[model samples]
Target chain A: MESLVLKDISITLGQNLVFDKLSLEFNKKVNTSIIGPGGSGKTTICKILNGDLKYNGSILINGIEIGESNNYLLEKYVGVVLNNSYNKNSLVIDELFAGLDTCNLDYEEEEKRVKKVVKYFKLQDILEKRISSFTIQKKYYIKIIKELIRGCAYIVLDDIFINMDLKEVKRIISYCKQENITIINITSEMEYVLETDNLVVLYNKNVAMVGSTIECLKEEKLLRRLGFNLPFLVDLSIQLGYYGLINKVIIDDRKMIDAIWK
Target chain B: MEIILQDIVCNSTKADKCLNKVNYTFKENSINFCSGLSGRLLRDLLTLKKQRESGYIFVNPNGRLSDIGYVGNNPLKEFTCKTVAEQMLYFKDNYHLKYNNVQEKIKSALLMVGLDESYLSRVITSLSTSELKKVSLACVLFYNPQVLIVDYFEKGLNYKDIEYFKKLFKKLKIKYNRNIIICSDNISNYLDILDEYVIFNNGVLEVKGTNKELYNNVIYKYIEEPHIIKFINLVRKKKGVELDNYIDIKELIKAIYRDVENK
Candidate 1:
């Protein structure tokens, strides 16, 4: 069964229609990245999945309708990391762990799980620091992966990489893949989006394209018409292919080099 | 006036050390680029509050350096006002006294950032990521500081908005004689606008030079050159077309269109 499904979703904020007739399905074990320019409804889609925004369509979670009684049940399966500042009312990392302890999971087992994730993301030293003292980037770094570690089947991160370095982003990607957690990464950078299993392109308040990363890149002209740029590595690979140096267009440098040498 | 720094260092408990023995100088009325990771280090440097040694940080004769503007990495979290008008009023009330009209200042700054004036009255919480970035830039431009420092100026901006910022920065240099310093990880994005470029690597000042010198010597080989330039060179080998270097698609399109028209 699909983990999550949105049917003909439409959302309007004030007088501006942000999403119109947008439909998407998240498979059971696939990582998807939503790519678009700013104001292309990436965050709105995440909000809809998290039940933070109201939309005019049907949303299903594991073949169950998303209503008041089942919304709390849905919360247990989904984790979200918003782009805004986190709550900063003198909460420590231990307190956050304690709060999650009430979810009826094994305390010792969960502690081991949390420590593994913290070590993976290299957040051991700042684990006891106050939320107010942490920067915006660090706050999301702890919240996003920790939520995923606590048995959440799906994770939604909203441009959490804008302030991160390339190394940090790679760590997050590896963590998601290792945990076997379905992820929905929202980003404007084409390089980051092309690393995922599927790509959903949002443009002009509608679904412009949805397919594999290579398929989306193949429609570079159409994507640019919707106000998005092709990934730098992808474009370079294509140019090299034109020069008969490469046989395929991709974002991986090692793969491109191998193809060229072969 | 020129801003110079020698043996500067900054460190917080979260990380071991951010800036270490960094030395550089910003010439008078010049655009300087500081590229590094996004954190307190870059933010502190942009606002001219990072640790530094003896140096002359000067402002223009008629310019004032009192106002400090912060364009955060996530622009949505930068603003605290309820409405866009209130956001403009917050800056005007605290920083500037020359222009008391909040709407006019908001309109002008929005136009400078390539945003429509009709967005002035919208609620701050309702904006998208790109729109939020433009609004944050608008707030900074509204203050009209002599020394304008922007952090990660191209983080969420599209190509059109980037071009608009380049033109607006040039206009500010001409009209108000402002000295602008922008910090980012991607230095090539601002190569056209910056007069000088500096890279912060491993908590030290790695290199600093003019845009042309740095591009020709250090950056060109590291980064992939634009596709159209590569295409033009590949197609026309013997008699090549002399195309100007551009970091954007619009300029490349214009150059190609002109070449085709001449043919």
Candidate 2:
């Protein structure tokens, strides 16, 4: 299986050392979420993974340093969906096909991949509409679709879902999982943490905690100390677990109800 | 002052109706949340930033354009000046408000928003996201508008910041008599603080309800129910246990403890 590894990475912005010798590993097809408070270098990590920032250590994907990876291979293996500003006058169709030629895929394969994602997202209705006409949430969806059309193996989502509706966010996440894309979501919102397979908590420019989502979440005190708003159910479960109202930390509302009433 | 939108219609850039003949009233000195399809359009109309295609909007008690204060998602983008003092002074100059002690008034405004006088000299860009948001609120409170619209209440905020803003909004409504309208599609964030919810679906007013009224209302059909509320409803439906509509997790936990112990 393809895996992404960050070995002893360090990034400094001017006088401040945002990250110092930070190390982490993420495997393919395992959706990992990195969460931290504001100014904790979450977005900086995204920039490093996308090869947009100059850092000290190497970022290896599939045992090869990302810096040495060919343009086509890099584009195919990694994609980033940041809330970056884009040209509003461009049409959705143009935005989708803007970087199609750069991908290693041939003409027919590229068109097929683009068509599949467009159809899945039901973008046929607004393909001709200017990006300026769509809402901020819709624009994010379009950006995600643009990345998905490239058939990216590892997609790093940089806090693009905070402003979106939760239901729609879950739907898109499930679709990405079906396509077996390794999702590295960096967010301040803890509610989306429950949807990921693994969790990475950043504090003081380093990894404070990292484990399976549920195992990492069980340490409520550390996460709280790290300045995260625990997901509602998680918080309630921990509270109830303390009171012996429920046996275990139940993340789902229905299961918690059953555990309580049983 | 109450904000009443009467047959208010807003069109998009393509001339399509974004807010279709919307009629709603945001009561004075209360906390209100507007969500759904045309929520942003409604925000623009309330601020008079976007001209309506048809109908009228009435801000009662002779409220003018300056009476409406809007703070969007990113408050840093709203700043034209560099320092906190300059932004406050710019508002004073732009509104032509004459004050006997302008410096003292600026300090007081900063304090009111939970910021100290030290922030006055700090550059706006140097402040953190939450600090910038508070500075933005301070700048808005300088004018002391009746209707204060905040877009995306819990986006960048942490748990403590969210709790802080909740108290601040309550203080704004109760002590200051300002109407707080938070424009966010996420209903979960406002469970503890929201007084009323006005949801729009497909460019039309879908439903308007108070706190308890939305516990089992049509709002859930469009938007997902908040986790606490969903659990409460599940207990009521599945186990035939009627738990109080407790917005606080602690209170709900206490109630559950009482019920489980009594059994």
- In model 1 chain A, which range of ten residues has the least summed lDDT? A253-262
Q: Residue-wise lDDT of candidate 1 within A1-262, one digit each (tens)?
A: 7678888899899888988888889886788888777788888987887788888988788888788777876677777877766756455556457546636777788687767766777776767678766644566666676576666778888877765656667787787777777888887666677768899887788878899878778786787777666776676666555555556776654454345434
| Structure candidate 2, residue pairs in collision | none
Checking candidate 1 for backbone clashes, the offending pairs are: none
Candidate 1: residue B64 lDDT (0-100): 41
DockQ of each: 0.25, 0.41
Query: Which prediction has the highest DockQ against the true structure?
Result: 2
The candidate scoring highest on lDDT is 2
Candidate 2, B1-263: lDDT as tens digits: 88788887766653223778888899998999887644335556766678988899887888666787877677766899989999989988888877899988888888877788988888876565667788888898888888888877577667766777789889989998999998877788788778999887767788888887768658877667777888888899999999988878889989998999899
lDDT of 1 by residue, B11-52 (tens): 653331365666667676778876653334543554566743
Local accuracy by lDDT, each model: 0.68, 0.80
TM-score per model (chain B): 0.73, 0.91
Q: lDDT tens digits, residues A1-262, model 2?
A: 6898888999876456878999998999889999877667777887776767788987777888766546345666888886555447889888888757567677788778778877777789988999887677787888787787777788898888885767668778877888988889887678888889999988898999999998898898887776667888888888888888866677877888888878
Q: Model 2 Cα displacement at A222 (Å)?
A: 2.3
| Candidate 2 chain A lDDT trough over 10 residues, lowest sum | A66-75
